[model samples]
Target: MNDRLGRLRDTTINLAHGSGGRAMRELIEDVFVMAFDNPALAALEDQAVFPLADLVRHGDRLAFTTDSYVVDPLFFPGGDIGTLAVSGTVNDLAMSGAKPLFLSCGMVIEEGLAVDILRRVAASMQRVAIEAGVSIVTGDTKVVERGCADKLFVNTAGVGVVPAGVSISARRAQAGDVVIVNGFLGDHGTAILVARQQLALQSDIESDCAPLASLVAAMLDTREDIHCMRDATRGGVATVLNEFALSSGVAIRIHEAALPIREEVKGACEILGLDPLYLANEGKLVAVVPAHAAERVLAAMHAHPAGRHAGVIGEVVAQPAGIVVLHTGFGGQRIVDMLVGEQLPRIC
Candidate 1:
């Protein structure tokens, strides 16, 4: 019995595990608990019960965010959709000055998907959630008919608490404020393109799908001068800047020279006729800070493991109109418009 079950443990999660029987308990203990060990999670309950603390005790503000991941190829250069789901949601709350505490995951698997692939995805999600200091409190799973669903799709919703004296948003940008990005641009998007488009480019571009909750907390701790924080996800920097501009009723002018475009990414974009500004990034962010605190903020960003390539990509301006303008490297400017057509569909 041990050997037969041991083989099951070594293999993938079968339908029996989702059947809510002994197979399910064995699967959870062998995989999920082993990968994400925590006292809260060890309870083995459907819903985790814990207290959300606050300094003032007046039900301090909290941040909640949810995102779905459907990256093709399942696995990519740097990370997979499972990890991307956890990181993406955690980073969203972090950007809002929140300390992520818990997460709920949902898996949509194709009926004929491989069990090993499912295990790999689940393990990746567990590892990332643990590393981010967040717990996967609960999750649901569903299997769709082969052609009706992709190989896999993961959705994650995170809950975080924001303490007093810390408020950040897209509407906080003001004139004379400096905009900073956590790292080089276009790596994640181009990496996916390389994988999905089957490009022959061989520069080893990697996806930057990493959790940034701790890094965000570090920035807020070191300085209170940060005006706003946002990750460069879909629609990329162009979209983020436009959001800030519209929310704050201000105009933003980005410096093309200061933009962080890696050599490999530049090469790939040139080859594919793509623009880096509109490219999506999973592990990068745009931080708007006062001009006076720019140096310190940039320094702090550089000190973090995830922010070594931080750059001051743009600035907030009062142009009597709310818009995002891009200054070309050739000394001209153009409106960085929101995406009209799908550039890369299903790119989470």
Candidate 2:
């Protein structure tokens, strides 16, 4: 592994930086390779190689997923695009009750982007990858004209091993199951809105962007019988509940009173005429577990830092299958449908 960070002569990215030549090599070696130092990455091979036996020890099946991130503002209060890229991919693999292991990062950089900014982003990715217990084994990079692309865009693909006897899926939700969430919702969305618009709102809402594999591991340790698990990302909890309902052919009813939302996020949503339920949450997850295991799982979630504000928001029902209903605090009920349009674009 490259123990020393590589230094670049250029202050900003240029077309030459993306060219498959000396500049590109320096960028890869000095920035990405140094930050994500590992044997597989440091080898500088065309592809990352791993021992099949290493994977077999974890499980018989492999879970793979990929996602792209292009948040309007690369940097946010709690995290940057680099952090979001790694955490998002890791969380996707963890939703399947898999132990995340490896990731591949791809970046599309715009010409004139500050070299320092790219380095900062790379450092963020490495920090989050370490926290998620994953290695960045391979990656690709490209540079586009200044106006052709945003300042930067990141794509991350991840692979993990699903342990034996663990089968968690959205379609596994069943009637009489309970829904639980890890931590507050809508903070990511609210934070982006505030940052993008430069809103002078007095709020402490920072993007709840985090890697949730550890929290998921804690939950599985407490109860491997978890039925459904999904990180509430772009579409938030409302979208995840609807997916569970549709996939399992069951009804999911959540109580507004039971939701765990921060006062700052709630107030921001109200001021912006937004529904916190549909706001994005990078760090939160909606889990459906057997009713009997709900309390134990919630207790386990509470024990983890990521799930400190975990709560049992609702449960599944037999009637009105393929839909999600929300019991309002105002002594009324409403159907929480999927988001009609993009509420906040470029939000991870």
Output the number of the TM-score-best candidate.
2
Residue range 1-348, candidate 2, lDDT tens digits: 444445678889999989988888889988888899999998888799889799989888999999999998999889999999999999999999999999999999999999999999999999999999999999988999989998999999999999888999889998889999987889999889888875659666788899999999999898449999999898889999999999999999999999988888888887878899999999989999999998899888899999889989999998799989999999899999988888888897
The residue-by-residue lDDT of candidate 1 on 300-319, one tens digit each, is 87899998988788889888
Assess candidate 1 and give its TM-score to the true structure: 0.91
Question: Clashes in each model (backbone N, CA, C under 3 Å)?
Answer: 0, 0
Candidate 1, residue 324: how far the Cα is off, in Å? 0.9
User: Whole-model lDDT, candidate 1?
Assistant: 0.81
Location of the lowest summed lDDT over 10 successive residues in candidate 2 = 1-10
